[model samples]
Target: EAGVAQSPRYKIIEKRQSVAFWCNPISGHATLYWYQQILGQGPKLLIQFQNNGVVDDSQLPKDRFSAERLKGVDSTLKIQPAKLEDSAVYLCASSSTGQWNNSPLHFGNGTRLTVT
Candidate 1:
């Protein structure tokens, strides 16, 4: 089965420090997304991209968070001056166009970031 891949399965960082996470989506999937999932809350879409171009990023904090999908394949998200509240599981997901509503999305375990 196809799935997304993330690095640094777990990380602990000090507040005000910087960190980065990486993701590789399933091959051939054109839509990629980054989500932040905090305890007790559902995953929230942080950014979405279509073939290297950003489709939506309104919810992302431009002041501290940034992401990019190079060549529309592998992507990376960075957080600078991390805050305690920034601790959460960062998820990466992908799907073929028009696939949503037709099938359920498969999401793998993502990077867990903890700020102390």
Candidate 2:
């Protein structure tokens, strides 16, 4: 099976600018997640989607970030007016339905955004 895919392995942006990242999860997976991982820290869940519907987005900084999975397949995340603190690795993962904890999520290499 094909693995998860992400674009622009690295990005550099100035503060107050906008940026977007894309993700394509593994085929047949039903749950997808986006995480923000700062240097030397565990990945923090930013948003989750069960198919095309949102499952959790409590950790997302709504004031500056937004995402969507319009067809329950590919998804995108965008950051508007980026801040210096927004620099991090944006990771995307996927797992089978009803097996979140049991199924190990597959991750992409991620888009490393550097907010200047």
Candidate 3:
């Protein structure tokens, strides 16, 4: 399967600035997920969506971050008033089904954000 499409592979911004990243999941994928991977640590699931509805967003920083999947095909993640600690690789992954553990995740190259 082809990889999920993600844009703006790298970004540099000052602290408290806002930035956004876009993603297009693979065709026929019913589940989409966003993750934040800090250096030297495993990727942390930020949000999960089954089609256009959100399945889970417990780990997402709602005060500074937001994401949406419109019509179930594409999605976007945005961070407003970003903090220095928010610097990390933002990953977009898709799976054949909503059952995350049951389906293999096809991940994009990811957008690396740098907060100065």
Best by lDDT: 3
Q: What is the lDDT of candidate 2?
A: 0.94
Give a tens-digit lDDT track for model 1, residues 27-54.
8888888999999999999998888999
Per-residue alpha-carbon lDDT of candidate 2 for residues 1-116, written as tens digits (9 for 90 to 100): 99999997999999999999999999988899999999999999999999998889999999999999999999999999899999999999999864346888899999999999
lDDT of 3: 0.95
- At residue 74, candidate 3 shows an lDDT of 95
Per-model TM-score versus the true fold: 0.92, 0.96, 0.96
Residues 1-116, candidate 3: write the lDDT tens digits: 66799999999999999999999999999999999999999999999999999999999999999999989999999999999999999999999876646988899999999999
Which residue pairs show collisions in model 2?
A: none
RMSD of each: 1.7, 1.1, 1.1
Segments in model 2 whose C-alpha atoms lie over 4 Å from true places: 99-101
Q: After superposition, which runs of candidate 1 have C-alpha atoms over 4 Å from their true positions? A: 98-103
Question: Among all windows of ten consecutive residues in candidate 1, which has the lowest summed lDDT?
Answer: 98-107
